[model samples]
Structures are given as C-alpha cells and as structure tokens.
Target: METTQNTFEQFKLNRQLLNAIEEAGYTTPTPIQEQAIPLALAGQDILGIAQTGTGKTAAYALPLLMRIKYAQGQHARALIMAPTRELAMQISEAIIQLSKYTDIRTVVLFGGVGPKSQIEAIRDGVDIIVATPGRFMDLYFREEVTVKHLNVMILDEADKMMDMGFMPQIRKLLEIIPVKRQNMLFSATFSEKVERLSHEFLEFPTRIEVTPQATTAEMVSQTLYELPNFHTKMNLLSHLLRDEEVFNRVLIFTRSREVAGLVHQYLLGRVVREDALRVIHANKGQNTRTNAMEAFREGSVRVMVATDVVSRGIDITEVSHVINFDVPLMYEDYVHRIGRTGRANHVGQAITFMTFADEYHIRKIEKMIRMEIPRTKLPAEIEMMETPRNEMQDMLREIDNQKRKEDPTFLGAFHEKKAYRPPSKFNQKDSRARRGASSRTKKR
Candidate 1:
C-alpha cells in the first residue's frame, strides 16, 4: 500500500492498521505524528519532542504496530517504557485500540500489582509490552520476559523516567536489548539528561519537535489568582466548580499527596454527587487509582484531584479545565499540568491559584513558558484572608534565601544552624546536690 503525501494514509501501513487509524478518526496527522510516523515506519529511530496529549502515542505506536505485522513469539517484539503505571497503561491502551483489527497482542507491566498475570500473558505470547522500568526489569530478571526478539523500543516521557530515577534500570535495559533494534524517545521537554539518554540509547535518531521546549499548548488560556491563603483558594475553587459549564470535566493539580487528599475530601464532602469526584495520589491503591482515572475518562466523574503523579502521565481528553490548586514546586510541571487540559487541538482553560509564597515559583514557571499567567481579580463575594502562619514562614524563608544569595553572611532560618550548648551549671549542680542528698538519706 504505497501512499502519496501528507496524510496518515500516506504511510504504507498494513490494511488493519490503516483501517484502525481511519476508525480512530485521525484524518490529518498532528505535527509530531506527521513528522514521526513516516520516519518510524521506515525503521528509523525517532526523538520526538512533544507533550503528553500531542498525539505522540500515535506518532510512534501507529508506525510500530504497523511494523510488527503479526504476533508470533512468546517474547515481546517491541517494548515501551514509561515512568508511571497510568502512562504505561495508557500507551498499551492506545496500541490495543490501533491494532484492534490485528492479532498483535500487548501486555502492560507495572509494579503495584502481582506479576503473575503479566508473566502468564507474556508466556502466552505477546508482540508488544508497555511497562515501567522496575516491573519490566523484574520480569526480565525472573526469566519470564526477554528482549532478544525486540525490533522496536520506545521510551515515552523520557524526561519523567529520568526525573523518577529510572536511569539505572533504563541503562541496564539498554545493555540487555538487541543492539540492532530501532529506538525512539519522546519527551515534552528536552534537557541535558534527555540528550545524554538519547545519545546512549538512540542511534542516529531523527529528531521531531512539534512544539518548542517547555512551551505550553497554544490552545490553553492561562489564568492566575493571587489568593492570600489556602482557605481563600479553596473558597475560590468551590465558587468556580459551581459553574458546571466552565468547570466540567476538570482536573485539579496540587503539589503534595496531603493537599491532593485535602482538596479531594473538601470537594467530595461538598459536592452532592459523590460519584462525580475522585482523587489519586501515591497512597491510593492501584485499583482505586485506575478506577478513579477510568471513571474520570468516562465522564462518570466530573472532578479529579491529583498530585503531580499523573501530571505528565495520564491522558484524559475533553478536560475542560485544569486548576492548579497549588503552584507546582517543579516549574516544568506547570507545563505538564496545563497540558492535561489543552489537548488534541482543543481550547481549554488553566487556572492557577497563587499564594504569596508561590510568587517566587510562578516566576520560574512563567519564564519557562515564555509568558506570565494573566491575573484575574477574585470575586467580590469571596472574602480574602490573611497570610497563614506556614505561608508567612515560607515567604520569610524565601526572602532569606534571596538575601543570602546576595551575601552568604546573611542569616536566614534555613541557613542558620542552632548551636549546641552544654548543660547549665545550676541544673548540673542541682542534679549532683539531689543525688548526694539521696545518698545521705539512704546512709541514714
């Protein structure tokens, strides 16, 4: 099936893969897909620079699925490594959907669950394995999985995998896999580390970047609120969530599991429809997390409160808004967080609640994305509160940090170490006196 130019059909994909692409309703290719698919189909290694929702999965998966014409061996012929279970499962799901008309089999391997089923699936024969670094390595070491037959290898969110400290496992896998296999790495942002990984893994790879490094999707309208404290932020959030038209299918991102839980609980308790709210963090069980995400995807849940855990991983299309209940400490995550909303050419909203302490963090984020988030006035009805004690302390610490940067001698709470002093003379004397008095009394 020799294809002409500029369309997904332009790639000489098999009948089933082509049919799946058509059935999947992908007519014109995304920029990343446009550049990557042809190169990947030609058995070339690819370094795709695109965010999570940029159709990158199809860019590589479509070509890889087409390449793996049939399911023949017990060992996987292709492997995709992701940092999180959600991402691994998502990639697998995309592959399955694309290859629905074919016999190509895929199994997702991630930690958090028993490997018995995964091992059995691999033993039964699979052509593709989408796995996390740890679980994949576990199965490999246990002799239940092998890469000798692998012809294509992909690392999605390579930056994230590196961030999560998966390099050692990735390096080990690099050493184990066949040297001649085609390798592809896709990331939302490029860094020195990603460059290093690419050099070590991909051989003369064709680089494709649909968007610039750290650039947020142009489709997203970014907004900011300078709330004084957490309670005000929550009040504002509650006010916004009441507007079903704008806040429908929302994802709220927080910095920590604690905040994720708090936000989830606050919303869960207030929303009359309990089934419409779900929370996911590191503490949630695998089934719980999966169910929550799945429910959110299916529109059964209107709100999802998540930590950075799924910022760069989960792909929930049709998210009308992404609310940053707390500014991300890691600036890169702001890009990823907003990405969850403006996906697949859809115009979306990204609202960030910035406290006094978050000013320092938001500057870095704005600089990274090359634009400051537009500040919106808080509703006149919402009562703003004073800076909380913790926030005040954080501001003081930040100020001290800046002062110390100017002059190392500047003492801040963080830089000042409490000095240790010996026990007081009076106390020591009192202890000795008491001990002597006790001894005398015992003697009497």
Candidate 2:
C-alpha cells in the first residue's frame, strides 16, 4: 500500500509493522518519528531530544521492530532501558502494541515486581527486553537475561536516569552490552549529562531534536496561580475540578509522597466523586501504583496525585490538564510534568500553584523554558487563606538563601524583622502535614 511520501510508509517498514502502526491509532508520524525513524532504519545511532506522550516511543520502537523483524535466538536481540518501572512497562507495552502485526516477542523486567514471571518470559523466548537499569542488571547477574545478541540498545529518559543516580549502573551495563549494537538515547531535556552519556554510548549518532530542549509543548496552554497558601490552592483546584471540569484526565504532581497522600485524602474527603481520585508515590506498592496509573489512563479515575516517581512513567497523552500542586524541586521536572498533557498535537492545559517559597524555583523553571508562564487570578469564590506560619517563614528563608548566594554578607530578612521569633518546635502540622516533607521546607 502506497502512503504519502512523508508518512511511515516512506521509511520502508514491513507491511505487518505498518498495519500495527495503523491499528495502534497512529495516523501520521510525529515530527520526531518522521525524522528519527529513517535514520534508525539506516542503522545509524540516534540521539533524540524529545519527551514521552509525543509518540517518541514508536520512533525508536518501530525501527527496532523492523530490524528485529521475527524472533531469532532465545536471548533478547534488542534491549531498551528506562529509569522507572512505569517507563519500562510503558515502552514494553508500546512495542507490543506497535508490533501487533508482526511476530516479535517482548518482555519487560523491573525491580518492583518479582522476577519469576519475567524469568519465565525470558526462558520462553523474547526478541526485545524493556527494563530498568537496576533490575536489568539484576536479571542479567541472575542468568535470566542477556544482551549477547543485542541488535539495538535504547535509552529512554536518559536525563531522568541520571537524576535518579543510575549513572554507575548505566556505565556498567554499557560495558556488558554487545559493543557493535546501534545506540539510541531519547530524552525530553538535552542536559549536559545526557550529552556526555550520548558521546560515551552513541557512535557518531544522527542528532534529532524536534523542539528546543526543556521547551513546553506548544499545544499546552500553561498558566500559573500565585496562591498564598495550600488551602487556597486546594480551593482553586476544587473549583476547577468540580465547577469547571477544567481537567478530565488530570495528573497532579507534588514534591513529596506525603503530600501526595495528603492531597489525595483532602480531595477524597471533600470532593463528591471520591472514586475519581487516587494517589501514588514511592510508598505505594508497585501493583497499587500500576493500578492507579492504569485507572487514570482508562478514565476510571479522573485525577492521579503522584510524586516525581510517576511523572516520567505516565504514558497517556489525552490528559486534559496537568496541575503542579507544588512547584517541583528540580526545575527540569516542570517540563516533563506538563508534557503529560497536550501530547500528539492535542491541545491541553498545565496549571501550577505557587507559594512564596516556590517562587525561587518558579523563576528558574521560567528561565529554563525561556517563556513566562502566563498568570491567572484565583477565583473570588475560593477564600484566600493566610500563609501558614511555617510556610511563610520557609518562603522568607528561601529568599534569604538566594540573597546570600548572591551576596555573602546579607543576613536573612526575618532576622531584621520582629526580633526573629523562633519557629514553634511543635509545628508538626507544618512539617508533617505539608506533604510529610523534610524540615527545610517546613520553615516556610
């Protein structure tokens, strides 16, 4: 079947793979897919600077599928590494979905779940292995997996793996994998670390960057709310959710697991649709986290309160909105969080709630994205609560810390005002209740 010169058919993919792409709901090639596929099929290593929810998985997966064609030896022929179990599973699922018209067997291995099932899959036979660095290594050491026959190696979200401190493991994996394989590194932000890793792993790769690194998706309408306190932020979120239905499949990002829990409880307690809310963090069991994410994806759950644990793990693109209940600590995460929405050229929204303490990070995020996040006013219906004493102090401390960074001699502004009242030692509510965060953030 002849397709447009610019379509997936132009890459000369097999009919089975082409049929799978069509069945998988992909009608046209995303910019990254259009550019990256042909190069990958040409057996050139790829350095792709793109994000999830942008059809990037298929860009690398399709070529890998075409090259691997039918299953060969029992050992895996291609290895795909991801930072999180969610991402590993997501990639494996994508490979399965896109290879439906073909006979390639795939297996996903991660640490959170038992390796017994994964072991069985490998023993049964697989052509591709999608895995996290740590678990992949563990499985290899246990003799359940191998990369001896690898034809291609993919690293998705390489920056996230770096942030998760998986460099040591990644270095070791590279040492073991077949040296002659094709290498592909795909990430949302092209940080210096990713650049360095690319040089180490890729052999004169073809560079493909669809958009400027750290740039938000143009289809996403991003807006920020400068709420004074957490309650006001919640009030605004409730207003949008209950009144306006501004978010259909909303992914809410928080800084800590405790806060994720708090937000879930807060919403479940007040919101009429208790069944529509779910939360996940490092604390949740792997199965529970997976179930929550799946529910959110299938629309069984309307909102998912997740920490950075699942920010890069989420694979759905039809998200109506992404809410940053708290500004992220790592500025780059702001890009990944919002990328969850407005994907595949579909328009969506990203709403962030910021307090004074969050202001410092917000400025840094804005600078990284190179565009100001448009500001929106809080609704009059939602009462603006006073900034909690600890939150206020923490915000002031952040400002002071910034000032000190710029000028060594500057004392904290709190020190000059009102005799510097010592914060209450008993303010567990400030520390624990606010997402069960560490002590540093409790000051504000």
Candidate 3:
C-alpha cells in the first residue's frame, strides 16, 4: 500500500490559490487546515477549535476564497466578524494575501478610524467584508452594507467575541443576514459561551479540533519566575533582554495599557534600542498601532510590548520569546499570549513573571492548560529589588480579594477587624449613654 503526500494541492484548490500558497512559502497544510478545508469546501458549516498561530486563518480563508471565486457584484457575498480591530485587520490581510491571484476584493471595517475610507471600499466593490461586530452593525444601519447577497458568514475568535460581549450584536446580525448561508465559527478555546454560540451560529456543523482544547503549542518551552513585585519583574525582564542572541525577537504581554506603556518605557534605551521597541494597547492611536505592528513584523522592532488587544489573531511567526510581564486574569488569554511564540513549528520560549497576587491567577491558568509551568530561580548576578511598601500592600489586598471571591464567607484581613471587635472604653461609654436615654424615655 502507498500513502499520498499531504499538501495544499491535494485539496483541489484552484491554480491561482495554489500559486499564491506556494509563493507565500507554505509547503504543507497544518492540522487545522488539513481537517477543516475539505468540510468547508463541501458546503458544510464548520466549528473549528484550534489554538492561535495554528494556520486557522488559512483553514477558513482558503475555502471562503475558493467559494467566492471572483468578484461579481458591488456588494459583499461573505462576512467575517472578529472581536477586535487588530484581529479584523489581521484576517483581512490574510484573506487579501490568499486571494491575490483572484479578483476577489475584501474590505476591512473597524472603529478606531473613521469609516470614510471603508465606506468608499465597500462602495467601489467588495466580495468579502471583514469587520468587528460593532463596526459592521454601524455600517449596516447606515445602509452602506447589504446582507442580501451574503452566502457565507464566519466568526473568527468566537470565544474572544463572547468575552468582549459581542453576543447581542451577533444575534442581531443573525436576524438580518440570509438564513440560507453557510456558517463557520473558529475559537482558540471552547468554553460554555462558545459552545452556546456555535449552536446558534452553525447549522448541523462538522466539528474539527486540531488539538485538545486550550493546549499550548508543543514547541514552546514555558517557565515561571515567582518574583516579589512588579519592580523585580522589570529587573528580570531587563536581565533577560540583555542577551541579544536568545532574546532577539520578543513579544512582552501585560494585563493593562498602563503596564504595557511602563514596560515599553523601562526597556527603551536600556535593554532595547529606542527605535527598536514598540508598544500597542487599546488606547494607542490607530495609525500608531498599525505602524508599530508593521514595524515589528518587518523586523525593524526587536521588542514589542502589548496588552491582550493583539493577543488572539495577530500572527508573527519569528517571535523568539513571549514574556508575560503580568499574569492574565482571563485564563484563556494565557494560552493566546504564549501562542504568540512557537509559531509555524519554531522553537520559542514563554517566560511568565508571577507576583504573590498573580499566583492565584497562575494556578487558574495552569489548571486550564492542564500543566504546571516550570519555575526557575533568579540568576545570582541579578539583584532582587525590594518591593515597595505600597506595592506590597496592594498585592496583599489583591490576594485577599481573590480569597474572598473563592470563599464568600471568608472575610479579608482588612475586613476581619470590622467583623469582630472587643468592647472598647468608647463603646462602653456609648452603651451607658444609650441606657440612660432609654430610662429617661421610660419615665416619660
């Protein structure tokens, strides 16, 4: 018996897509692609469960492009919804690349910038509309987008959309679009919310899971550093980035925009060059974020610091290390953040900095991923900075809050004093005054 080779050509894609795939340097299909493309091509709705950086975009985009074939009418025939503007743009770029040899035009809609240009793109001619839910609905209400011609609808990062509360808009969209269209839903992790969304979005869909849900990439090595405070994490980050060979192309993730900015500022001109470090968050301008992302992708930026805004869909294959400057409270996002590295079967490192308060979240993340991250001791040469008094108090308060959340009856340290108090001299005097007032009232 002879076995056939697994290749994109085996899918019977058109010559144009085959050419584009070859030019794009794709040798073979990824697991998700191998499993999903055929079902999608057969006009079956797909529920794809795959982690980030697993060629999920291609798995869906290729089939969508093949179905669209060529641009025909002035309206879009397909709609792709993403949770964030960054992810919307990323998917649009991938679709454009895959459909280069064809005449299928795609227009990306997002809210950070004005809709003037996007409206113009739609007016000119578009076969596909890739957009965030809010922006898509905005354009739809304005009569700029018509769903009558839509034959396909896809929800990329459905779990993220559920997290960001896009369900109402999604439900509204479902009502407006043609009910006869094929549907596809892709999620990095399958949660209860995602499962419910899948039931609502897809009709008797064929489910494909390339990997066990929420599992990290096998090529990435994960390590944890239990530091005392944020300052010590900064110290460890600085020390790690000093070694250029190993830390060459790095992505640092923080939980908030403020932390992302601080990480960028700390590394500027100290560990990374001023021009080689870029930061992005929800607060950054659209142009600034796009330029920073482009620069990082083009290899001009050595280190990019970002919040979870860019975690789910932005695909950068050469990331050498992903430094979790702060543990993510949303445990699923931990999988997406580490996935920024170890892309395309490349060996990568994921280093997490966990403070005392972060330990609770880290445990939750480990439980979700079904493995404990290896802990490493700080190098002897790097001095562990003493945590400031205020920061220590904040961490303690956070820990107390976490504990209280887990056990509602368990009062926090600050609440313990209020819960039980011995009778004081002031309390005794107040009690005597109350008793005298009660006796006076009784005499009256």
Candidate 4:
C-alpha cells in the first residue's frame, strides 16, 4: 500500500501544531483520523465508532486544535469527557503532546486526588479541559469552570462512559453546555444507550463505524487455556512469564484493583526481579497510578497488571501480550481486553485463562465473535491440579445454581441453605412444573 502521509503543512494546521505532530513521530494518519479529521475540521458533528488503538485521539484532537487555533476567543473553548481518571489524564497527555509548539492550554480533572490543583489549573484560563464526569461535575457545579463559551465538545469512549454509569452526569453536562456548538462522540462500540444519549447532544450527526460490531481485530491471535481454577492459572502464568520474550511488555487484565494487587504479589514471588512486575488500578493514588503507567510505557516494567478501568485509554503500541487473569463480565469486554494488543496491523497474542465456570462465558464469547478460539494445553507441572479442578467445578456449579435461581417457576427441590440443586431438576417453567405437580399427586 502506498503511504498517504504528507507534510503536516498540507492540512493547513497551525505551523506550531504541525511541528508538534512531527516531533511526536506521527507521520501517517490512521484510518479513523484520515476519515474523521476532514469532517471534524469542517465543523461537523461526528459519531466515530471504531475498535480501540486505531489512533482515534488524533482523529478528533488534531482537527479540534486546528479549529481552536483559527477561532477568536480563548476561554476553555473545547471540552473532552473521558470515563476514568486515568483516561482523562491520558487524553490530556495526548493533547499536550500534539499541542507542544502551540500556545494552547489544557487542564485535566479527576476525583481520586484533592481538587485544589485541578481548581487552580481551571482558574488559570485553559483553552481545553479533559476531565472525568464526576470531578468535572463537581467543579462545574461549584462554578469553578464555565462551558458557556465552549466551542467544541468531544466524548471519547462514549460507550465506556455509559457502561460506567455516567449517563446522568453526561446528560446534565449536555444541558449545561450551550445549544449551538460542535459535538463529537467517539467510542469503540455504539450501544443503544450511546445512540440515545447522542440524540440529546448532537444535531445532524455524521455516524462512522470503522470496524464491524462485536468483532475483534483480525491481527490478534487468540487462545484459551482451560485452567482447573485460579491457582493453576497462576502456575501456568508463572511458567509463561519465565520465557523472556513473553515476559517483556506483557499486560495482565484483572477484574478489580484488589485482584490486580493479588496477582502482582503472586507473580512477584515466582519472577526473579522485583521490578519486572507493576500493578495499577483505581484504588491506587494518582501519583502511584501515573508512575506505574509511566514505568510500563518506558519499558522499565516488564509485566503491568491493571483493571478494565485503566485499560481503555492506555495507548501503548508495542504491548506484546494481553493475559486475561479473570474473565470479564461482558462478552464484548473480551474483545476490548485483547484489543490492547495487535493494534494498527501489528500482530499480537491474547491468552485467556478459563475455569469451568468461565467455560460458558467463553462459549458465549465464541458465539458472539463467530469464531472458535484455539485452546492451549497446560504444562505438565500444572496439569496435575485436581484441587483447582474441584474448585473450578464447584465454581461452575455455583454459577449454574445462580442461573437456575433466576428461573421464575423453579420450585424448591430441597430444604434449608444446605440444600443441593442439581442441573436435572432445573428446567424451564411451563411444562416441567406441571409434570412435577402431576407426579407428586400420583405419589400421594
């Protein structure tokens, strides 16, 4: 394929911004940026839906910076709303990198730390504000910042914001901002709720989806290992990380910060170097989180463990492998987790640890993704894990019991909390309940 990159001068962007883009080593525009930038520059309301790691930040940021540079006033004209504190900071960093030579000022607002510094930054009169919903609302309500002069608004990762339950905050923000302004909603996927929210914010929007819905990147090679349970997963992971190539730049995604720390400690015991592994999650303070992310990006940390909250906005390109320490709650999350790697035509691997309980979820993921993920056998040392097997089966039974509990007509087959619920007794309500009643009457 021919390279479509031209001198930044061709875009008619401010000379300073162009210099910064060149300095940042962004020679070519990714597909999303190439398609969306022109429309956004023309002052169009854009709804851009593409998988993560497609360079969507520049797709909107470059044009917004250009527009802001060309226009008159300089009072917080642009606002970018991200879902998490980490993401908000990441977007702010991108803006700074892209606007290095320009005189544009930016501020990031998030709740984990104190608000004094953020308030001072806003008071200093910035041209752009990148913020999470909670802290932004707090400052907005306090009248520390005003959107009355806002020119452009961008919602990066709109679906994630919705998934994190920020709809009410987003709606309030929309109502607060002036009616006549440019708006853009960029996300990995557009669910029904995202569409509904967009209708309230955007006027005559141009919708664009770069990738198919519910599909993962084609460049990612996915594999699943049916571990007996958590401990055996740890054993397998220890073995895999021992391979120097795989240990370098590995990212492990867990469900929560507590889990991330636990995994990090467990891995630390087996790994030779203490500095090889780092953990980042929401519970950590801002400085700790920033240091961890920086270490991961600069190649100082070999294996970085994180929760989903920190995963979306992380833009590291050379991540070697993504390990799913815990299966995600939603099938779409599997796609997102693996998306951390194999970005922008670079081949990468995604290894998932599945227990018996996770088997059904894995199957559902396959059905949704429409392809069978290759299964990998555990190493011999980890194979003799009968204890984890029992735990795995017990976990599966627990999940099955929960599903059966949800069935409306499921009658009590046993008494007390000690009762055992078998899969055979768990059946659909209409026919089976009547059959059971008739059988009981015959016995009577």
Task: Output the number of the TM-score-best candidate.
Answer: 3
Candidate 3 residue pairs that clash:
none
**Higher-scoring candidate on TM-score, 1 or 4:** 1
Model 1 deviation from native, Cα RMSD in Å: 11.9
TM-score of each: 0.89, 0.90, 0.91, 0.87
Q: Residue 83 of model 2: what lDDT?
A: 94
> Once superposed on the true structure, which residue ranges of model 2 sit more than 4 Å away at CA?
1-3, 407-411, 414-444
Model 3 residue runs over 4 Å out of place are 1-4, 417-444
lDDT of 4 by residue, 121-153 (tens): 877778999999999999988989888999799
Model 1, 228-315: lDDT tens digits are 5687788889989998877889999998999888888888758526888888999988999999998998998999999988898677
* Tens digit of per-residue lDDT, candidate 2, span 308-415: 988774768689989999999888899888888887678998999977667678899999999998988656455555557787777778778988988999977877
The lDDT per prediction is: 0.84, 0.83, 0.89, 0.80
Window of ten residues with lowest summed lDDT in model 3? 419-428
**Model 1 CA lDDT for position 114:** 88
User: Worst lDDT window (10 residues) for model 2?
Assistant: 422-431
- Expressed as tens digits, the lDDT of each residue in 368-443 for candidate 3 is 8999999997775554555567776787688788988999887787765644222241122443465567669889
Which has the better lDDT: candidate 3, or candidate 4?
3
Candidate order (lDDT):
3, 1, 2, 4
- Each model's backbone clash number: 0, 6, 0, 0
